[model samples]
Structure formats: structure tokens, C-alpha cells
Target chain A: MTLLSRRHILAAIGAGVAAPSLVRAQSSETLKIGGMLPFSGPASIEGRQIVQGLQFAVAEWNEKGGVLGRKIELVLEDDESNSTKGVTAVRRLIEREKVPFIIGTYASAVAIAASKVAAEYKVPMLSGGSTGAGATDQNTAGDPWFFRSWPDSNAQGDDTAKAIVNKFKKTKVAIIHDNTNYGVTLAEQVTRVVTGVGGQIVSKDGYNAGEQDFSSMLTRLRGLKPDAVYIGGWAGDGANILRQAAEIGLKAQFVGSGSMLSDDFIKLAGSASEGFAVATMFEASTPNPIGKAFAERWRKSHDFDANTFSALGYDSTNIAIEALRRAGKPDGLEVQKMLKDGMKDFPLVQGPAGTTAAFNEKGGVIFPNFIAVIKDGKRRLDV
Target chain B: MDLFLQYVANGVVTGSTYVLVAVGLTLIFGILGVVNFAHGEFYMIGGYVGIVAITMLKLPVLAAIAVVLLAAALVGLVAEAILHKPLKSRDATNSIISSFGLAVALQNAALLVMGPQPQRLNLDVSKIPVLSSLPTDFGPVFLPQQRTLIPLTMVILIGVLYAVLKYTWTGRSLRAMAQHATVARLCGVRVQSVAVVTFMVGSALAGIAGMLMSSIFFVYPVVGNMIALKAFTVVILGGMGNVAGAAVAGLLLGITESLTSAYVANSMRDVVGFVFVILVLLFRPQGLFGKAAERS
Candidate 1:
């Protein structure tokens, strides 16, 4: 140690303290992205898995020296699967946190509600799980910053209708859906597609989510004697409806949306779940290089099996990062423009569903559709 | 006519479930003079307990039900100690507020532990003799073995509870406390003990309902929230503190729901149920079978 004057020592201390921040300030520091997740409600199971995938992606990116020399930071807000709460969460992310990007909302209604706020503030929002048709409709009065990682219900409904008519060879079908934006809209689309294909819809019904008693509904449907029953809802409600239908001895062949193709659905429906078919995006049994690696890493880290939601979440994060890279800066407008211009053909990783994860003009993902059935108490890809 | 019978049968089955949940709530309210708003959470807890018993422990159906009853009773006992006993007043509003908080806490605890996914009990009774042997007429009057079991079990349990309340020493004490808590305490009745028994019995009833329905409706954290509202409606329709009335009204409400769903639109089912409640309140505020307001 050399003795020095007070001014000399002060100058040396200032230099040491200022050097790191100067480098950080020049390199753009850390970029924060907001996440509005349902971490504490009925959809928490899916939300937790989704966040796991997002965190995994962020960690991997940081390990390779983060995008634009700045580590990505995620600011999470719990939407609780409620539309009002989801709006508040998005507002906080935009107004207070000032995050340029947001990904979230397991429920479609919540996503639609939050997107309004995102539109008002001019921030880009990518929904990881919401599949409601309203999430991306250009007709909606909003700034076109809303995009989704999964295909909308209209696409699924059209595919499901095709499967029911062409493959199952069913002409008379009854329909029931959960009374939510996702379920109701999907049912509407399915009805449209079925009628368009000349299939007669004999009966239409709706029930609240979390309702377990479908004895009366089944009894009424049983009287009609339709050739098949189409359920537009998530797995939990679908399983309940299927089990009750079995208990009531309603023998209509059952078909559900892609949301029903999960291990949980199989476990809940049990033997009643046998013969039920679903048209879904992701099938865990499907062999894909990217999906296998993601699953392996997920299982090793989380000590649990990853579902389709997790895979989509991982893919969505990658898409956002790519857009960030293409933008070449942290400005929200630049990033949104870049994504709108080229995200449709961007070469993203192959999803677990074994489809190239590409977006259409409406921010809807374009992927191959596969039909699955619960056979021998497992979700097996049928066609 | 066969379809009519089927609707009736369906109503009875649905009503039996309502009776199990409503009677317990009325009994607790009558004795404790505190509306246990967390009653639904107890029902939810019962479902979870039943799942654990049947799936994890691999217990038989009856044994699983027993475990659920015991566990839910214990939870109710602890809840009474922590939440109810501390309240300075027995006002309905006070109890409602405290129990509502308890309800939120319990639901959140369940979500944290169970991960918000619904789990099934996986108990099927397709081959039971008595249930299978039941006479059925085509599509309408058909009653599965498991569906028949709901009303049968409800009748048996209600009979037992009635006999116990009518004959047992503890039953007399509970009735006496319900009539006049201060007078009973002054007359040497152990108020604390009666309160404990009330919660236990009420919680056990909720547990039994959850266990029985777990096979059909499945088990989840929010499973009881909606059913609890319907049960409350039944309690009010049958007279706020009348157990026998809850049983009768529950069956009536269930039938109404079934008929409404069949003849009217499905969405009109709950609306009709509430309409019945409104009409009952307008005409007979004491409920269909309840006694007129009395002065001590």
C-alpha cells in the first residue's frame, strides 16, 4: 500500500465504483419481461408448469450470454384466473413495472381482458395458453399487440368437426360446453363447422365450470339419442361430464377439444374415459428431437412429467427472445413491428406436438392437428 | 311416464346430497348460534381426505368414508377453537366474517397442497347386487347401483341422527342448548361440550356427503363452494335451524331441479330453485315444514 493524498484516493475509489455501471449502462443492463400467470387458482397446476418452462428458457439463454448482452429478468404477477384481477395485473406490469413485453393468462377471458390494457399502454402481449378466438381477432378495437402461442379455438373446432364427421362418421351430434369464453366460443365454432359439413346438431347445452352433477343434462341428452356428443371444455369438466354420462348409461360416443387430452383427464375419467377422443396440439408420446430434450431436462429438474402447456410455454419464450433479437433494441414498438413482419416464418424449435411452431397473420400458431384417444388408461395418438 | 320417474329418481339422488350438507349446517347454526361459513371448506376438506384414503392408503370404500368423517370432524373441532371461540359475540355477522376468513384460509391451504387439479376417488360400484337389482323402466326410471346408494345412505344416516337426538343424553343436551343457550348453561348443561359435539356431527355429515359424491362429482379444492351455496338455500327454505325440514326441503329442491332441467332449459335449473326460495320466503317465512316464530 502506498500512501496517497485525499483527492488521489477519492479519484481511485470513484474509478473502481463507476467502471462496472458504465459497462452495464452501455450494454443496456437487464431487460425485464412481465408474466401474468394464474399461480393460485383452479388453473394453478397449468400455470406452475408454464412458469417452469419459461424459467428454464430464461436460464438457458442467460447461460449462453443473454440477448443483447443483457440478462433477461421476468416480473411475475398472479392473475388468479379472474378477468378483473388479470386486468389489474397487466396494468401493473405496464404502468408500474414498465416492462416492454408480457406473457401470460391461462384462461382466454382473462387474456382478452388483459390485452385491452396492454393495447391501451402499447405493450406487446403474447399469451402462452389462452386459445379463445377473441384473443387475436383483428376486428377487436385495440392496438394489434396481442399474439398467442397456440392456435385459436376456431382452428381446433374445425379440425374436431372434420374428425367427427369424416372419421367417426357421426351425423347426429349433441353439444355441451362450459360457460366460459374459451368453452362457449369453441362450441360456437364447432357448431358452425359441423353444420357447414352437413352434420345435424340435435341439441345444444351449457353448464357452469366446476359443476359436477350432469345427471339431468345427460338424462335430457339421452332422450334425444344422438350419434355422438361433443364437449367443448377443459379436461376437468370434460372428465366430469364423461364420467356422469357413463354413470347415467348415455352411450353417445364422446369427443372433446384438445384441452381434454391430458394425463389428468385419463386419471379422472378412469374406465369411462375409454373410447373418448380429442383433437389436440401436443401429444407427450410423439417423438420429436426438441420435445424429447425439453422433456428430459424438465423431468430431471422438476421431478415431474411435463405437459403440452409446458412445451408451449417453452416455445413461446423462445419466440419472444427471437423477436427481441430481431428488434436489436429494447423498445416495445420496434420489437412488435419485427414480430409482426417476420414471426410468421421465423424458424422456431419444433413443438412437443411435433409441429413447426409458426404464427399466422392473426398471431395464431399454424401446426398439424392430431387426434388422440384414452386407450388402456393412457393418452394415445389415434390419428 | 318412465322418463318422469327417472327425473324423480334423479331428483331424490340430488336432494339426498343437499340434505347431507344442509342438515349439518342447520344443526351447527341452531346450537352454536354462529353461522359456520367455512362449512363448505369442511366439505371440500372431506373430499380431499376421501381421495387420500381411497387412493393413497388403498382403503375400502366404507373405511375411506370413516377416515374422511374423522378427519373432517377433527378439522372442525380445531377450527371452532381457533376461529369461533375467540369471537366476543355470537352475532351472525361476526361469526360470518370470522368463518369467511377461515374459509378463504382453508381453501388456499388446500390449493397450496393439492396443486389445484381435481383428483378422482376411482371407486366404481357397478356390480353391487341391491343397486343393480333395482327395477328400472327403459331410459327414464333407470337408477344405477351407485345413484341408488345416495338416497339409501341418506335415509339410514338421517334415521340414526334422529334416533340419537331423540333418545341419547347428549342429544337432549344439544336440543336444550339450541333452545336457550344461556338458560341451559345456567341449568348445568356443559355448553362447551355441546358446541364441540355439534361441530363434530356437522362436519362428519359434510364429510360423508363429500365421500359419497367423490366418486361421481370427483374431488377438488373448490368442489364444495357451489354446493355449499345450494345447501344454504336448502337450510333457509327448510327453516334456518330445522334438521328434519332440511331433509324434506332438500329432496323437494332436488326434485324441482331435476324437473326444471328436463322440462325447462338446463340453465333455468338454478333459477327455478332460487325462485322457489323467493316464493317460500314471500308466503311462509318459517319454511315449508318449519314452525311459526315462537317466544320463549
Candidate 2:
């Protein structure tokens, strides 16, 4: 199911020597695919995942012969996770690299910035990690050139209520967040879900980012005493809460949004991370064939595998390739048209669908989330 | 009651950090007769150097702390000699202006080497036993290692500073210079050399404070802004150029900040800390521990 990669550095080095002719030939026949992601700074972890995912699919695609008759020549750039840098990376990828299509710039701020550039350039840009609605919809009818692979927070949360009822049967849960808009929105989603399911939110608490203390909040939480606490925050503050909970013996099962499935969270929490369950859009540790293959490949190359962000990138790359194949020409306008037509679950070997991937008008995968729990220092499927 | 205990615990820890920061700022003013505006960047340097020592060089935490101190001390020595000495000898304002420039340069240098995202030591406070001494649950107000260590360090540091200033020949020289630099030079005191050491010691303390802060606080590039500014307030509130004054002021500032953040919104903690300093300054323009005859 996976290729046994040999360390053919000599061959690859030899290929590097002959790269000029390949470049010359590549110029004539290859379709330039640009990629921009946060390769440095705070968001570098997610950036690396996106790069790996894009590389994996691109390798697999080339292995099966290039998209259409032209080889995909990917031009990668680092946005440093800044919106300003994202614009520079996108502009460089567009004007300098002359990429006909692009698959990146993951941060919402970055995605929003790069999409504007893509719209300006009239190049089809698909971002998997950027969940900001503005990435796709700000100028949808007027522009139509910009697109996103992942659904924004609104769509993801719309399904979260049904997910809570059908999946966890969670009745009474507490929602904790960092008081940021992102955190508040996510908590509101769970709150809506819990209430809609005739469940009660026993408590809700919010803390500021970079807060060193959480004792009072946890104490307040102990009194409210819900079945579980859903943390709607990023790795740093959320992990601190988790650590504090373990120390204080606040033993309501900890649950969180997809952010909990990230390696950043796991790295921060360490062994204390055990028994933490999370609703994730994707988990690389799944028992499926795709999961098994990704695990093997990721392990061979690096110590840590792709988290949710990596899966998002992998999904995005395959979507771009399919859209390219469907579009036939390397024309950005044609590909944008194809993307708007809605890809109804084209054979994503790694997706929830065996061969189906579709985004409703909202550009969200109706695919089920892989609920995971940290058991024995590794993620185990809860459902 | 639990929340109260936790807040108290947090206040103590928070107070300790304040003491360290104030001492750094106060020491410079005490010795050089100049406000070292770049003191916060020294704190920033301490964090970056500590991270590089621990993460990049794979040194022990103690080694990281020591390395951060030594590295920052060297930077201070260089700044005093090449930067401060030339400028100060020219006039007071030149050194002051140069120090601000130095701060900007060091911060950008740090930003160039290590990007702007926050860098935690990649080590948890709970992993270190001293920090987790208190039961974990006392809710979130309890000091995890990162929060607890700074206060403990402040105690040890304040003790060391006391010992150095009271007992050591070097501290005597620094004191002599602080009291009367030109007169001390006539009295066979190495005033210039003492000034250099004062800067080094002050910087070393700031660096140590920064390293401790990395664990407790969000160790970001801009952390210098928050801590350095607090140190300034602490120095002014304690008594400008007063070592003993700085210590008392630091503790008071910390408790005030912690209580304020706990009771008021966390964001208002800074505002309240400064408000106290302003109120004190309004009453006593010379500062809380104001001493006449100390000109630099």
C-alpha cells in the first residue's frame, strides 16, 4: 500500500546534476504550481505539515505520471505566518515564479492576504488550512478566482451540534476559552450544540492568552462540575489549563475543538495529555490504510507525523491536482470555474470517502470528524 | 478561600519578578547616573540566549541560566565600554540616547535571529519539582514551575545582591562610585572600572530575571516591553538609584499587579501598577527612597 523508499541520494544527486535539462524541458511542459505557507515563526509547525502533505500528494501524482501531459513544478515560499509576508510570498509566487495555480498560505490572515493577491493576479488559489470565510466569500461573485478547501468556522460549527448529539451523546458540558474571538466562536458552537441536544452548559469560563494563572477559573469549574470541559483555544493557554486541571484534580474529561488534535497542543501538554479527547477533522493515527501509510512515511522522514493541518494540506493538494486534471489546461480561469462547480468527493485515497470528496456551497467537507483520545502517549480513536 | 490563597501565592510569585526587574533598572541609575532604557532588551536577550543554550546547545537549565547571565553581562560590559563610556564621558544625554538605540538594535537583532512568535523554554514548570511543590488543583492561581521559580529566584538574588553590596570589595567600589564618582576616584576608588562592573552585575541580574521570566511569562520577543516598563515604574516607586528602595518597591509592585489583575481585568494590571508609581511620584518627586548627594 506504500512505497518502500530507498535512500537513493546518489540517484537524486545525479538527477540534480541533470536538473537543467529537466528545468528546460520542465519549462516547456511543466505546469508551475506555487505554494505559500508559514515556514517560520510561530505558525511554522502547521506550515511544515502543509508542505509535507502537498509534497506527498505531488510525489504520488508524479509517480503516476504528471497531471495532464505537463509535470507539476511546485514553487514553494514561506509566508512566516504574517499576512504582510503572505502577500509578498503570493506576489513572488505569482509574478516571479509565474505559477498558474497555487495551493497555500495557511493562516486565515495569510490566506486572506494571499487570496487578495491571487484575485488581483486572477490565479486560482486554494488554501486548505485557512478557515476564514473571508478567504473565499469576500468577493466570491465578483472575483471567483479565490477558493478554500476547508470550511470556515461557521460551517464546521453548524455540524458540531449534530456531531455532539450523535457522536458523544454529551448532555452537560462546560465550555472554556481564551476570550479571543476564535475561542468564543468555537465555545458558542459547542454551547449551541449542547443546548440544542437538550443538554445544559453547566459552566462557561474565558481566560486571556499568555495568562500564567488559571486556579480561580478551574475552581469555579469544579463547582459547576460538568461531565466534560470543552476548551476553545490554541495550544499555549489550553495546554496550561490542562496541566492545571491535572494538578488540581479537576477531573471532568477534557474535550476541545480540533486545535486539541494539533501537535503543538500535545507538545505543550506532554504525558499529562493522556485521556484528553478531541473532535478533529482528521487524525493521522487512524487505523485505516491511508493513516497507516501516512504514519509509515511520516515516521521515516521525521519524528512527528502530520496533525490536522498536515491532513488539510494533503487534502488540498489532491483537490488542486484533480481540479487541474478536470480543467485540462493550466488556465487559472478554467480551474477556478471547475472549483466553483463543486468537487463531489473526487477519489481522495486518504479522505473519509473512499473516492468521494465534495464541498457544499459553503466549501466544507460533509465528511465525519475522527474523534481521538490520547492513550499511552499516542492518539487512539474513540469512535 | 481557595481562590484567595491562590491569588496570594500568585501575588508573591509575581512580586518576586517585579523585584528583579526593578533592581536591574535601579542599579543602572544608582551607579551611572543614567536611566538605562535598554534594560528590557537585556531581559529579552537573556530569554533568547537561554533558549539557545537549552534548545539549540542542549544545555541543562542551570547552564542555560548561567550562560544567559554571562552572555548578557558581556553585552553589558561591551555596552558600558564602547557604548556608554564614550557617550557618558561626552555627556549624560548621549549615553541615554545611545542606550535607547542599543535597545532597538538588540531587539531587532533578536527578531532577526529568532522570529517574533513567543518561545517557551519547551520545558514545563511541573516537570521541575520546586514549582509543583504546591498541590496542582488549588485552581489555576497556583504557581506552576514557570511562575513559582521567578519568586524563588528573586529571594536568592536579593540575598546575593545584599551580600555583594554589604560585604564585598567590588560592591564597596560600586557603592563608592554611586555615592561620589569623582571624589571616589580621588579616594583611590576605581570609579570607571566600578561603573563597568555595576553595569555588568545589573545586566547579569536582568538577564537572570529574563531567563526566569521565560518560564513564567510568555517568552515573546516583545516581552521586554512589558517587564522593562514595569522595572522602570518599580525603580521610580522604590526610590530612584536606591538598591534597598528597588527591592521593597519591586515586591509592592508585584503584589499590586497580581491583586489588580486578579480583581480587576488582567489588562488593567499594568495601568494600576503605573498609577501607583504616578501617585507616589506626584507626592515625592525624588522617589520613595530619595537620597540627596547621589549624582551618579
Candidate 3:
């Protein structure tokens, strides 16, 4: 009878430990896609929406059999809506989890920070919701590894500014924006567009993201007496500003960026939300077939209506999966090549009817922004 | 002139809320000598309690306020026992670190349970028939019935607190303890009970501020963070333990922020508080209303 020695036993155990990993590498049973989102910080709500959309798309794909004959698995990391946290999360996802592709990040600052890490690792990353101009602009001058499914701040600002000046015909405008990358960049874009269109900007100001008090700012705006007030902030702060504006009797045609296109804004603002116009990509009232299908499916699962965040997340995932299918392997460079070469007239859930997302040379998509106004607490398409 | 008055009105409204939060902080710091970094959690707790009372329990506005007070006081008692009491004999930094940890834990707990959605406590005075018909517009200044309640409530609360501190035997004991804990203990003052009472009162005030402000501003987990910083600034600018100084400083800070936003720039509003604190620390380190530093 043959007996094993101590060295042999140790070697056998080591082999046993290394065998499973080798098998895993060979088989590649599931393709893991990393998602970095702010699940706990100030932008947690948006993160939840984006995750929901991503989950829905993944579930649908799995039902039909995932890409490359393998079931798709999502490994998520919470960025906490912070840039530093975002960098750490992305590094962990790329280095530890070894995910070839990454999707994320609702906050613009986080997206910008995380995308640089993805570029450093040569892993293609797609942003579902971040709209800051810097997110794409910084990448364009570099490796161009980051792709955005959502419209950048410049597109939304330009469209909204045009509507405010030409459609609403309000020449004197006041801009109040949150001091984040998203708000600040959008405000700049709006300023550029408004001035280019010969509209006058009377007052411009920025506030912190979670700032609740806008009484002084509103009063100052009232003194300036701008015909229209453009708010470039998220739903929560926007609602507070609107409520305070109404309380202090600062009456003007209130306009906002796409971030205000959520039910939370209307519910929080209550009657103050009436007649508030915003530039948006996805509205629940859209007649687009893909959007309608997504909305119907989303409503069946969630108690709330589908908004732009979810739509963008769904489109971003589909684009990533499509690129994966084209690549025929879970390889970062190949997938990125497929994305750059193949993504054209890509069907999207966001933007106007018949609008499709296509990446520019800068790896950015410019979807047409539709102006929607809150009439009786419902967002109705205005222009 | 009208614009200036409007700015003042805005500042006063903002200041009243700050006063409510700052007074409680000063009371706790003055009496207990604990920095109480988690003081803001009590405010956040009060806001959540308000949501439960008004929205879920369907209580009236007055009843909701009472509920918030009771809940906050209970929480304060728990915090005193678990967080502050054991660390009472330790160095101040230990307590500060522990309290900071408690703040993070409580914030995460709230986030886990409530799911980070901004909730509004519906205290719409416009819904009441009598108040609805009242003129909301005062010439060029528009004072909504709801906003008018903020300063009025602050005044009433501060007055009652003053009267209680001035007349009651419990107040004398608390004052003695604040003046000198060893002497007060020797003179038959129950330092432990007084400390508990101080926490309860301080936490209750902060909670009430949260409840009142939640009606105007939406209630969320992190809602207390910004206000707590302002309250700290108020505490420092007023002299750390001086209650009256906190009240006046709160108003001054609020007005300064308002005028800064109005005249200088809106982005500069928050910068005004830190700049004032720095200037005050440089010139009058003892604070505007504080006497010469007493060597504890």
C-alpha cells in the first residue's frame, strides 16, 4: 500500500486549493459586470433608481440567456456619492473583482473620479446618469475609455436655455445652481446658451447641495426681478427652493434642469411645483415604444413611475451587453472596440420620440432634451 | 428699503431655527462639559418622530410636537446612560470621539430604516380655514402663516426655558452644578440627576427645532448635518456655555449669512459663519458674551 508523506499532503492541499480557481478561469460560468453607485450618501435615491434599472435589464437578459452563453452577474460597490469613495470602489472592482467592464455612478463628481481609475486600468466604463460635462471632456483628451449613455450637462442646458428664451420668451433670467460639478457645469452651459441667444442674465448664484434655506437668495432674486429663474439642482434642493420662493412671494417663471424631473420634486414642492418647467430626456408620458415597454415593466415591479434615471440605467446596460455580445468574449479592449465601432443609432429609452443614442468621437451621447412642465402635479410635455 | 426688510425677515426666520438648536447645545456643553457631537442626531430623531406622529399616526400639529418632545427626551436619556455616563470621568476627547461614532451609527440606522427619501411634515396653516383667509401678504413683505410660527415658537420656548432656569429649585441645582461640580456635589446637589435633566432639556429643544423646521424643510437622515454645523458656530460665537449668548449669536449668524447671500454672493453665505468664527477666535477667544476664561 502506498502512503502519502507530509510534503505530498501539503502539495495535494495546495493543488486542491488552486484547482477550483483554474476550473473557474477555464469555464467562465458567469460574466461579472461591476457597478459603482452611491447607495448610502446624499444621492442614494438616484442610486437606488439606477440599480433598479440595471437589475431589470440584467434579469431580462438572463431570462433570454446572458451574453456569450454565460449568465451575467452584477458585482456592485457603493461609492457613497463621494469622489474619494468612488475611486476606492472602482479600484476594488477592477483589481480585486477583476470585472472587465464597469457601469455606474449617478453623481458627476464620483463619475469623473471613477472613470479616471477605469481608464488607468484600461477597463471600459459607462455612466448611466452622470451629466457633468467634465465626465466626457476629460476622457476625450485621454484614453477615451469612459462612455456616457445619458446626455451631458451642455446638451440639457442648451436645450433648456433655448426653450426659456425663445419659447417662454423670458429675456431676463436668474440662475441658481447647486455648487456640485453637475449644477455648476449646467449653469455655465445655460449661461453660454442664454447669452448667445441675446437673453440677459440678471443674477447668478450657487448653493451647497443639501442647503435647505433659499429665502435670502430668493429675496435677492425678487429684488432683481428676473422674468425667469433657472434652477440647476437635484430634486430635493429644488423642491426646497421652490417652496421658499413661494413663501417669500418671489414670483417668476421657474425653469430647471433634468434633475428636477422626478416625482419626489413634485411631492416635496406640493403646490409650489405648479407650472415648474424642466428640460428632461425621459418622461413617463413619452410615446416611444421602448420607453413605454420599460415603463410598463417598471410599474409592474415598482410602486413608483419610471423616470430618467432608470431609463438611462437600462439603456447603459443594454449598450454594455450589446458590446459584450459583439466582442464574443469578456475582454476589456475588445468590448471597448466593439462599443466604439458598433454603437450607432442605438435604441434608447431616454430622449424625444424616435431619438437614438450614438457616441460621438468623445465617447459622449447627445440626446434631445424635451421641455416638460408640472401641471397639477403631473409632468406634461410642453415643448 | 423693502428689499432690506425682506432680507431681515428672511434672516430672522433662519436665525430662529438656529437659536432653537444652538441653545440646547450651549446648555449641554455649559452644564455637562461634554462637546456632545451627537447633539444633531437628537434633532434628526425629532424629525423622524414628527414624521411618525403627524403622517403615520395622524396626530394634530400640537400633538405631534408633544410626541416629538417626549420621544427626543427618551432618546436623550438613553444616550446619556449609554454614551455619556460611562465616559463622564474620562478626558473630553474620548467623549467627543465616542459621540462622533454614535452620530455615524445613528445616521446609518436612520438611513437603513427610512431609505433616504426626503419626507415633509404637513403643517400647512393654509389648510386651516381661519388662517387661510388671513392676509399672507404684508405690503411688500410676504409672511406666510406657517413661517410666522417659527419665530413665535422660538420666543415662547426660550421664554419658558428662561423662566424655568430662573425660578425652579431644579434650575438652581443645575446652575450650581454648572458653576462648579465639586462644590455643588458637596453642597448636596445631585450632579448625576442634574446631568440627566440637562441632556433631556437640551435634546428636547433640538428635537423641537427639528420638528418645526421639518415642516418648512423636508426631513431626511442628513438634514441635521448642515444645521448642526451652524449650531456649533452659534455656540462658539456666543461663548460655548452661555445660553443667552447662543441665542443672540444664532440670530447674528443667520442675519450675516442672509446679508452675505443677498449682497456679497449666494455662494458666500456659508463662508460667512466660518469667517466670523475665525475672526472671533483671533480677537475675542472667550466669545462675544463670555467672561474671562474660568480655569476649570
Question: Which candidate has the top score in lDDT?
Answer: 3
Ranked candidates (TM-score, high to low)? 3, 1, 2
CA lDDT, candidate 2, residue B276: 79
DockQ of prediction 1: 0.36
How would you encode candidate 2's per-residue C-alpha lDDT over B1-296 as one tens digit per residue?
A: 66666666766766677688778678788787877888888888887888789878988677677898899899889878855677766777887788877777676566556754456666545545556565444464544566666777888888998899889988887888887788888989877788788788888888888777666444655567767888899898888888888888788777676566556555466678778788988888677777645555
Q: What does each candidate score in C-alpha RMSD?
A: 8.5, 6.5, 7.4
Model 1 chain A lowest lDDT segment of ten: A1-10
Query: Which pairs, if any, clash in model 1?
Result: B6-B140
Candidate 2 docking: what grade? incorrect
Comparing 1 and 2 on lDDT, the stronger one: 1
Q: How far off is residue B14 in model 1, in Å? A: 2.2
TM-score of each: 0.88, 0.80, 0.92
**Candidate 1 residues A179-198, lDDT tens each?**
77777887788788888888
| Alpha-carbon shift of residue B3 in model 3 (angstroms) | 2.4
Which stretch of 10 consecutive residues in model 1 chain B shows the poorest summed lDDT? B123-132
Docking outcome class, model 3:
acceptable
Which parts of model 1 have CA positions greater than 4 angstroms off?
A1-30, A95-98, A138-143, A285-307, A348-361, B88-90, B124-141, B294-296
Best by TM-score: 3
- Any runs in candidate 3 off by more than 4 Å, and if so which? A1-28, A140-143, B126-140, B293-296
